[model samples]
Target: MSLLNGLPAHVLLVHVVVVLVPLTALVLVICALWPQGARRLGPALPVLALVTLASVPLTTGAGEWLERHVADDPLVRRHAELGDGMLPWALGLFVLAAGVWLISRRTPAAQAGARSGAVLRVAAAVLSVVVAAGAVVEVYRIGDSGAKAAWHDAYSKTATRPGDGD
Candidate 1:
């Protein structure tokens, strides 16, 4: 058998990292912050955040080309829209982290400033929460499309079957 498959590396990379890793990290973030246990589970927060953040641009850019070439279907369109929305949220979080990193360096020891306080914390939490929620929604959507897309062959089979075409 030939060693190389026809699948593109970009497509493979997108499925593995962008879709799975970020969602896994998002879940890990919540798990790491679980109320009852020690919070040692999330050592990779910064790394996870950075990876997820960096992927925003790459995914969206690849998507732009994919959208142009792929067959235009309602499901694909919806998927594109959902994927597109992730860019801004990811970029915003990355920007917020940068701002916090800069200002934290200048702030005093006793208080890390109000940016780490309830207001800003809550806002960041809300933004990430929304992004996570949207991701979940999109996952369900993608899953549904997968199910329907699988049926396309069966669908055509049934349509053409047993004198159906007359």
Candidate 2:
């Protein structure tokens, strides 16, 4: 039930979101741009999007809980703020993925070649690509801030200076 003996579930869960969201975004962009890929992906893109969207809240909730117990350092505060900004992008990706999937499914196969329907699909695909790109960027931003907050100091201390012991 607890991650590493109550070691803040966010520490563990953040990795999942970090990996899954970007991977999903890449696949989503591919599926959006390529009909063949979309046919192959079927429901996977939407499902992945949903999973990524769900993880946002879980990670943030765990992070929020941990925030109280940890040092009130500016790093942690900034990380929390960056994490909050990710939710909307994640939700947007989910909605876009769902819309693309629904549009693909509802549009009759026979009519998929029709001019207007084709245009609609193309438009949806473009939107999905844009939203997925945003989600990817947001994830990177969140992760980078978190890494800086968590490891910058530790890593800096370990780096050997040019004139050390000289």
Candidate 3:
């Protein structure tokens, strides 16, 4: 888990987390806000959420391993802290997605035109919006910090073309 194809595993696993988290969050919002979307896409949401949630641990574990090997720096420490915080957000998204799917799956007989069913759906929708927003923002923050940690001082202020020796 520490390395992949001779590169740090975090470099690869992070892509999975960065892509899936936002994609799954968008799907959750769509399924929550639109009934047609829910009916059409709800069945797959829980699985997507589960996959997204699962990636967080792998990415973070690999990140933690990478962190241990790299020199100590404040930027890296900040990025690692933000990366660790992603677990709870991912877990919340999964729980909300699963709940929404379950709610969508209730048969008419089971729902029985219950007021509580409608109430729960509304609640789930609200929570989905909040959680999705938070997750996206957190992902952005983590990515920005990670970029700073990895590339902040690795580049020159001005670019030079090939054979531009001075």
> For every model in order, what is the number of clashing pairs?
0, 0, 0
CA lDDT of every candidate: 0.50, 0.81, 0.92
Error of 3 at 134 (Å): 0.3
- Please, what are the lDDT tens digits per residue for candidate 1 over residues 1-166? 1111664333544554346544643643353233112123333444455676776567556655666765677766766666666655555444544433333333244234455553554554465556556555655654455345335445554345567445
lDDT value, candidate 2, whole model: 0.81
Decreasing TM-score order of the candidates: 3, 2, 1
Best-fitting candidate, scored by TM-score: 3
What is the per-residue lDDT of model 2 for residues 14-117, given as tens digits with 9 covering 90 to 100? Answer: 99899988887887777777766766678987899889989989999889888888777898899999899988888888887776766656546654668877
Name the regions of candidate 3 deviating beyond 4 angstroms. 108-112, 162-166
Q: What's the C-alpha lDDT at position 91 in model 1? A: 55
How far residue 151's Cα lies from its native spot in candidate 3, in Å, is 0.3
Tens-digit lDDT string for candidate 3 (1-166): 7999999999999999999999989999989887567667856999999999999999999999999999999999999999999999999999999988888788766566798988888999999999999999999999999999999889876775555563
Model 2 residue runs over 4 Å out of place are: 1-4, 106-109, 155-166
- TM-score of predicted model 1? 0.52
For candidate 3, the per-residue lDDT at 49 reads 98
Q: Quote the positional error of residue 101 for candidate 1 in Å.
A: 8.2
For candidate 3, report its TM-score.
Answer: 0.93
Pairs with steric clashes in candidate 2: none
Alpha-carbon runs more than 4 Å astray in model 1: 1-5, 17-43, 92-119, 142-166
lDDT score, candidate 3: 0.92
